[model samples]
Target: MTQFASLLLLKTVLLSGLALWLSVVVVNNLTAFRGGVFSVGSMMAMQLFDQAPAISTPLLSRRVTSEGWHRLVYGFVVIVEIVVALLLVYAALASLGAFLGYADATAAIGYANLALAGFVAMGLIMLVGGAWFAYYIRQEGAQITHFALIGLGLAAGLVINIPTP
Candidate 1:
């Protein structure tokens, strides 16, 4: 089709790919934490939830250990997944804005760049958490897999941020 339509399609594909990747990472991390391993990723993920208590006195009031910690970790994973999904939606809108020429290229780039950064950060968090979970589960075998997924996410984010030719 037209050049604009082609660009729009590329944007859609990138955002959808990002969302799908993040969802897979979240699900796999959770599953491994609950059933497979308790590696470093699991511990790191748990730490994110642990920090919430320090930032908020109310969360601190609630106990955070054992089963409590498990729930907290799971919650954090879910939250991260939700944020990734939202970012993908925003990415689509930003792409549409760009394709329609309703917004400047700079603005479109900014939105995509911001979303990419956010995804990368989230992916890092997921990696750490997944590693910790694997450690806890005593499944050191899965550490490499977790790292691979993180790497994939980072690479995808970087590719999406590249300026269109």
Candidate 2:
């Protein structure tokens, strides 16, 4: 196969991997809906801050105690995940089509860009939400995971956009 074809295959694989990752996340969230809601509620309620009362007391005002809001946020997150996953799957298919000469590389690249943008946007939303709830203060693992996902999305974008000289 030509180098261009190789690049397209690589792009397709990357997009498919991202789609699979998000799809699994969606399934997990749906299968454990209550658990997901509980996680969101804990973050919004700033429950972790209770362990550090000295620093947390003043920031307690940021807590969102409403169960309704927790469910809403979790629902929104799941919806976004589903949409992004679909986009990624579509983009991957477009890349594969381009490789097979059924579609142009430009179209595949455009779809990939859109999918990556959505992926990064979702990560940013979660990161910002976590920050608002002071998740970094105690939930170090969650913050790291969000940052890692954002990095992966960006890295994939770079990999797929390399010049095809």
Candidate 3:
């Protein structure tokens, strides 16, 4: 195969890997529903930073202590995860088809654009949610992870959009 074909294959593999990761996330969230909810609830409630000597601010007042709201937010997160996973899976398959000469690059890139957009949207949603609840104060690791995801999604989007020679 030529270099261009190799690049196409690489793009497909990357997209597939991302899709697989998202699938695992959805499965883990569903399988450990209570645990996932607890984690989110803990962040929302600012459990870790409530009395910590670290930067104390009135932002703690924004904490969501209601269990019902926790569950609702967790449900919404899962739904978005599922939707993004499906889009990525479809994009990966289309990319594979393009690589294998069964489809054109335009179709693959179109699906990839949609999938990558979803992926970045997920990252943005997490960033906004975490910021709203002041997760960055004590949950810097999670914030970093979300930023990394957004960066990877943006990089992959650029790769997928590169014109073929």
Candidate 4:
């Protein structure tokens, strides 16, 4: 294969890797959601907000705290995660299309824009949910490692989204 073909192969592979990674994360979240783990996680994260905003402050609801808000935010995060997973799936398909000659930079970049946005959100979600939640401080928190791993995973997606020429 020529240089351009090699670049195309690399892009395709990276996108595939990103898609697979995001799929795994989404599945894990879904499992956690089913297990009612997100509820606990959200509460813990919110607790940090009130007592530890110096440690973990949410964007809009930092001041108006309540259990109602915690549940509300948890629901919102679940929806956002599902949307992010959808975006990743779309980007992977577009990447495959690019490989197969059915798509181009515009198409791939379009899907990638959405996926990249989701990746950013995923990184922040883990940061606030883990780092800000004092997961790193906790001796028993399971999410400390998950937070770091997911943040790295999202960063990898950004690297994969870089345009190749």
Candidate 5:
């Protein structure tokens, strides 16, 4: 395969991976995100409120309480995830189509946008939802590592999407 084709394939893989991973996260955390009858979205919200330390010490600095705002934040999170996942999935399919000779160079550029869109949303989740809301602290810094790795993956995909001479 040509270098261009290889790059397209790489972008396809990256976008598809992100899409699949997002779907998995949502499915795995249904109790925390779903709006269904049995869903415990409120519990997840309570968890969010609990993260905010009552007494703001010199170490942790600021704390946020989302008692009544949990569902709203959870909804926002779900919406962002849904939108980004759809974009990634579409981009992956487009990238694959381009790889198979169905599209031109412009499709390659679209892949970068698709990846960036998802990654930017994810960055918001990491920074705003995780760091600002202290999800990392409450969850033992669990998602921090995943967030960094996803950033790296998005960067790699973006780098490869740059046009070559």
Candidate 6:
């Protein structure tokens, strides 16, 4: 029973982190749409085209292009997101093992702590990722993405120090 409880807690934390990350991604994309810089379709098109910047009048008129930089930034965001997803998956699996009674309660608690640590780490990464995204967005004349990032970071911190077993 104790093992199951720990597993439940771990699953909750992992799922919550994933949900928060997805929310942040959605909010960021929405902000981009509101800026009129690019629609979802246009963004998809750009991504399809090797994620090159749109050849709009403003961008084309500039001698020094920021397309490469933009691509690099987006690529970094994607990589971080993938890492977070993997961490969450590992947490889920650990939780599953605990719930199945395949692991002792004490060990399950330790696993939970590790999962929480991963979540906290992912949250920090997301915060940094969001800051970078905000910087890039601001350069493109958009608002910051700090709110979601900060909220997630705080939530993750709270979960990380949760009492185990």
User: Model 4: per-residue lDDT, tens digit, 1-165?
Assistant: 766556666766766776686678667766776444545544454444444334443442423345565566566666766777677778778877877778885678677777867767765775675444455443235565555656665665566566666
TM-score of 4: 0.64
Q: Which prediction has more favorable lDDT, 3 or 5?
A: 3
Number of clashes found in candidate 5? 0
Clashes of 2: 0
Q: Model 1, residue 56: displacement in angstroms?
A: 36
Give the lDDT ranking, best first: 3, 2, 4, 5, 1, 6
Point out where model 2 deviates above 4 Å.
Answer: 52-55
Instruction: Give the distance in Å from residue 13's predicted Cα in candidate 1 to where it truly belongs.
Output: 1.3
Q: What's the distance in Å from true for residue 49, model 4?
A: 15
- Model 3 lDDT per residue over 1-165, tens place: 898898899889999999999999999999998898899999999998856575677998888999999999999999999999999999999999999999987989899999999999999999999999989889999999999999999999999888877
On the 0 to 100 scale, the lDDT of residue 101 in model 5 is 87
Which pairs in model 5 have colliding backbones? none
Better of 3 and 6 by TM-score: 3
Estimate every model's Cα lDDT from 0 to 1: 0.59, 0.91, 0.93, 0.62, 0.61, 0.48
Worst 10 residues of 6 by lDDT: 134-143
Residues 1-165 of candidate 1: C-alpha lDDT, one tens digit per residue: 776557656766777677666667666766666552333333543444444343333333333346555656666766766776677667767776777777665565566666666766665775675543434243344556656656765775565566665
Candidate 5 or 2, higher TM-score: 2
TM-score of candidate 5 on Cα atoms, chains taken together: 0.69
- Error in Å for residue 40 of model 2: 0.7
Q: 2 or 5, which is superior by lDDT?
A: 2
After TM-score superposition, the amount by which residue 2's alpha carbon in candidate 6 deviates from its true location, in angstroms, is 6.3
Best by lDDT: 3
lDDT tens digits, residue span 22-138, model 5: 778666656554453123233343344444474343434443344446556666666666777777777778877888888665765666586665667666565654555454545
User: What TM-score would each prediction reach against the true structure?
Assistant: 0.59, 0.95, 0.96, 0.64, 0.69, 0.48
